[model samples]
Target: MAALMLQGTGSDVGKSVLVAGLCRAFANRGLSVRPFKPQNMSNNAAVTADGGEIGRAQATQAIACRVEPSVDMNPVLLKPQGDRTSQLIVRGRVRGTLAAARWREGRAGLLVDVLDSFERLSAGCDLVVVEGAGSPAEINLRDGDIANMGFARAADIPVILVGDIDRGGVIASLVGTRAVIDPADAAMIHGFLINKFRGDPALFDDGYRAIEARSGWRGYGVVPWLADAGRLPSEDAVILERSAMSTGRRVTIACPITPRIANFDDLDPLRLEPGVSLLMIPPGTAIPDVDMIILAGSKATIPDLAFVRAEGWDIDIRAHHRRGKPVLGLCGGYQMLGRSIADPHGIEGPAGTVEGLGLLDIDTILTATKTLERVEGIAGGARFAGYEMHMGETHGAGLAQPVGHRADGSPEGAISADGLVAGSYVHGLLALAEQRAVWLARIGVDAVGPDHGASIDAALDAIAATLERHLDLDAMLALAQRAGHAATNG
Candidate 1:
């Protein structure tokens, strides 16, 4: 009945990845393990097979544990929006938007529901490994903090503080983090794990002792830097940085790095292609004359649309259309290419009117009723099956219907005239081998070199195999079992 919480010294300290590793490790021990994050801030989301929304990290963790993902895994998801506001998702659906200050003041009331979900999941599982967001030492925002220390404190779960030594000053980072957290919160950290250590673990022997000595915390093990994580479906938008092109072929995509980008995973399949170079042009970068320009999904579509206009990318996109280059949009990106996007429910921004790029002549009205479903659809005359989660509806006579069919052979997305601009609510449309290969072929890039899904699965297996080599699974399970027993007693 006890849970073990994994807290990091800071954000991006490998907490998510470590939690995933632990989940796989526990499952390998024949224990039914589940992953939990009371709250998460991520735009990379995954639509469960049942049509619910959850953080992609949790989804990946579910994959690691070989289980189906549910909303209980990540009860609260905060996706950043422009102007100090964020789009809040609760119980796998969009609740509304709240400024950071307002959210902090109002979120405490929701912790009960979050704990209810956790309790429900914990009841059915032999072990649950909870992942913490950000850092426990963020003193300023700890009042309503149910994600890290707060969640651990509420659940009475023992914590394993993971620090990134590769980022330098691991000892200081761990010790300082421990020093700043409130006493009650700090007491929950039963041990610490040094992750992403590059060089010899023996060389940092003194540093490990320094952290243990300085913080008075136990050292689990120094996990080496894992390079095989490429095998998993990435949940971080920053993964686009690794996309490269082969010698003669390339895929040119213009993705405006807005203040709140979401569902950026739509570009993943392109990154794996040796012949495709996925170019994510920021605001000031010239919209290069490329084969295609992709408008990715966004959490804050209304404002991000204005951003596209402000950065003059809208003009560039229009030019690309005029020049007969192919352009594709997904989810929010699809909404932006339409004639108009109306926010009647104040979901994304202040209740207002926003004009779309007018490329599709469709009008989308934002509604409180979210459209979340696992859809099978057609795109560019290809059969594609994917999930769709959105809050807007599009309708117009000039709108182009879907080109692909679902499992039942039903048409699902919108393909414009001349088929130059295509839009879909599906995020992973390219994960299908033929879909990607055909898209790449259209863009003058060859993508038939490797099967994308098999390659990704192999990569995930490699990451798991690598971590299995580095960490002691038996020791970790013993740690969790000890924590769970203590939690039950407490």
Candidate 2:
């Protein structure tokens, strides 16, 4: 099998989108393509068909390849629970928490498993598109790096360095990466691609060539800003800062942007509605007047609850609830809506119990075990398929008014007596058109949005077509083929 890795000059440089677009582009050519990322750091995760969890981006890429997502696509996932510590997931299961001081060492030991997953993933594939984490220019952490150049060198995969011209300093970022990284690591990069170019591609030809001339890498092509990229599920939380306000929408739904927000894409479908406006309320801003408020998933329930209170959003939510506005919570957000959340074992942080927003009568006890599964359920009389990924079990009288039921008829989620407040552990429910329509009707608006899943597939195809035009697909295929030949002969 042939493999090519895309490493960026820095984070949010469009490496994930590029890998995904290429996966679709190659798969469109009738190649058996698979997506692989040796390691990933993101709280935005997706449950796979094998009952495991991986980065959401890998799952999207799997969709791009028209394949089921598997844990082997991303063997090592680091879900940050806080600024200094992260929950480490290996092969789709949580291993333990990794501290900042031990991050380099902790990840170094996973190279064996990472490579093992890579081997298994590429075995039956014509091409495996690999995505590197962060940047190779982070030489200080390069000693035990398994996310970028280190993985490329060890796996003998060819690397294509990608630079974001929209971020400015593209010439310096690309050439400086080669200048700072170890010479051995630099040799792994076979070429360079400029991404997110706003204006005409020819306008940046001199600058693009300057990077190749300075770094001794060939130029693949310059890709203009892809409007369809916004339609795909984004893995980075930084994109939340760029959430634009939709004007003249009939209904508005607001979600507070918590520091440890996980699976924020749960609201992406709502953003697509022409009659709906999804507002992501950032920190220090009070929740504005809206038809509904959604408490999104959180990586650290206790800490994020504190953040909600600290930002005075708790006050805003209660006030909104008093006004008879609807409120919904998912996963950790559901935990935060409970009467209390106990973490005696310190699974998230210090061992203690914290009072919740008291929106629901249920109580939650954070446990060591995590639930990771893809499920189908009925909510609001609408059948929906989603996944559950959480660490707490919630129970209370509020559950008597369940929001839905599982396929086996087990009650799931809770609703308030007034039916204005609801919470569930299921993520991606909005992606189902029926479920989304039900929620829209609850907010007094008719759903006019297209099928969310179908829209995503169409967006992937559009992106593949765009990449085919801007990128040198034949050259890229030849490069990957050469790597395959080396792997076989070596």
**lDDT of all predictions, in order shown?**
0.79, 0.92
TM-score of 2: 0.99
Best by TM-score: 2
- The weakest ten consecutive residues by lDDT in model 1 span 241-250
Model 2, C-alpha of 316: deviation from truth (Å): 0.6
Q: How accurate locally is residue 454 in candidate 1, as Cα lDDT from 0 to 100?
A: 65
TM-score of each: 0.93, 0.99
lDDT of model 2 at residue 80? 95
**Predicted candidate 1 versus true structure: per-residue lDDT over 1-490, tens digit per residue:** 6478889888888888788877777677688888999998888888876667899899889877889999999989887867888778897887878898899899888899789989999998899999998888889989988888778878878888989988898888999988898988888888888898877889999988988998898888888888766556666666665544345545555566765678887776776666666677765666778778888888878988988888888888989989998888889998999889999877775798788898885788988787777776556555566688787888875454664667776555577877787787787888877777767776677776445556655655666676677766566677778877876776
* Candidate 2 residue spans exceeding 4 A from truth: none
Error of 1 at 334 (Å): 0.9
* Index of the highest-lDDT prediction: 2
